[model samples]
Target: MRFDKKIIKYIVATAILALSLYLSARQIAFDDLIMQLQGLDYVWVLYSIPVIIASNIIRALRWREIHTPLSTEVKTHNAFSAIMIGHLLNSFTLRFGELARPIILAKKEKLPFAAVISTAVLEGGVDFAFLIILFFISLVFLSEPLFKLLNFDSVFQGSLGIFIIVLVVITALFFIYRYRRQLWQWSKSILPAKFASKLEDSMSAFVQGFVSLRNPLFYFKMTLYTILLWLSYALIMYLVSFAFAFQSAIQLSFIDSIILVVFAGIATAIAFTPGAVGVYHLVVASIMTTLYSITSNEAFAYATIIHIITLLVQSCIGAIYLIYEGISTIKLGEMKK
Candidate 1:
């Protein structure tokens, strides 16, 4: 069953990747894209490497913060290593890294897997909220141009309505869970006796993992770290823009970079392809060509270069950590079980 699931996942990922590649390639002159890449200044592109590394380190630290409330034994280095390994795996497998990171850390630190997994879930929720906030900010700044360029006015309006509905629903559910003591009784009535008992224990541990939220100072620090982590990501994109400095018409400023970051974030979030391969390129290239008036080939070239650099950095660091920890890709997969 597991092998069949793996095969299915690979098939889906390959299909998405192939579709993305075709969409991106069909509109661009591949020869021109290659020539543009070969002629660009690589120094600025290389500069993004250290920035990416720094961002990952900040992310590890942030993850440690999230985990510390669950278990004081969580080491920053171990958290960092696990994160790197997860990224490495995510590049190959569809989001297997999300599972692998927590499992690997749980095994190494002797922590409860459920508790560790809860912290990861919490982190994702927080990050999702942040991304939504960024999306709105970008929309505010570029609304007129963006709306005119993509004719996304209706789409944006619909998305906003959906966001509000989802937010209200989630908020209501949380309040119900918090205030309704009978909620557990109701759940127990429906579930099998053994499953209900296990669910009760899991919920207790999961809530305990969020003990850090009770401390205002820690909450503030975590919020600050989250902001810093995203800023680092934007900074990497901004730096890479300098590589294409010779293309005077491109004119990618810091604000442009932030907009692109938000677009890329949304694209990757919805994308099923491993590392967001073709989808990222399409969104990026489309944005440049449609909104910024850059040629398709040039935009595609820029997207490809930056994406490759990101993958290379993630894969290389992840490989090194896997070796140091004496963990194989297969072993990482096993950790999920």
Candidate 2:
């Protein structure tokens, strides 16, 4: 059954990637794309390397803050290693990183696995909130173009409604889990004694993971770190644009880079393809061609180069970390079991 599920996930990821590639190719000529790739400026692209590394470091720091209130002994370097391993896993698998990240950290720190997983869940929620805020900011700046591209009136309204419903449901579940001991006793009146006992223990640790939120100062620090992490990402995007600008007619301001970054976030959220492969290229190329008046070939070339270089750099760094940690890809796959 587990093998079947893995196969199914791969199938879905392949389908999404194939679709995205088809969409992107339909808009660009292959020969033009090749020509653009050949003439690309390498220097400005190199500038994004240190920027990307800094972003990952900041992300590691932020994750440490989230885990600190739970276990003060959690080493920042260990957390950073787990994060890089997670990203490396994510490049090959669909969100397997979310599971592998906590497992790796829990094993290293001797922390409760459930509590570590809960911190990861909390981190995702915070990231989602940031994505929503950035999306709205992009909408404000590129209102007309986005509206035309996305039919924002209907799409945004529907998406907003669904987001609100999901938020409410999640908040209610958090509260219920927060009081799981009492709830477990109540459930024991009807549920099986063994099941209720197990559930109570699980819920307790899960809620304990969120104990960090009770510290208002920690919350503020986490928010600040999150901001810095994203700023580093935006800076990478801004710097990469200069590479394309030198070779093509694709000069973009920092704000424009933010808009593209927001689109990339949306693509990652919606598409399950490994490394957000084709989905990112399609979204970025479409936005540049439609909104910025760049040629389809130039836009696609820029998207492809930026995505490939970022993927290669991060994957290489992650691979080295995996080796240093004495972990292998096979071992990461075995983690799911």
In order of listing, the candidates' clash counts read 0, 0
Cα deviation at 155, candidate 1, in Å, is: 6.2
- Where model 1 places Cα greater than 4 Å from the true spot, the runs are 1-8, 142-144, 150-152, 245-247
The sequence of per-residue lDDT tens digits that candidate 1 reaches over residues 1-337 is 9999989877877988999999988988778888888888999988999989898889888888888777776898898888888888888778888889888988999887888888888788778778878877876674456767645777577677969977897999798879667887888999999999998888887777778778888878778988898888888888887888435656677777778888888888888887888999999889878877888888888888888998899889989989988998677667766
Candidate 2 per-residue C-alpha lDDT over 110-163 given as tens digits, one digit per residue, 9 for 90 to 100: 887788889988888788878788887777665466766667577778578868
Candidate 1 has its poorest 10 consecutive residues by lDDT at 142-151
Tell me how far the alpha carbon of residue 262 in candidate 1 is from the true structure, in angstroms, after superposition. Answer: 0.5
Off by over 4 Å in 2: 1-6, 141-144, 147-152, 155-163, 174-183, 186-196, 246-250, 333-335
TM-score of 2: 0.89
Error of 2 at 62 (Å): 0.5
Native-to-model Cα distance after best TM-score fit, residue 142 in candidate 1, in Å = 5.0
Error of 2 at 223 (Å): 1.7
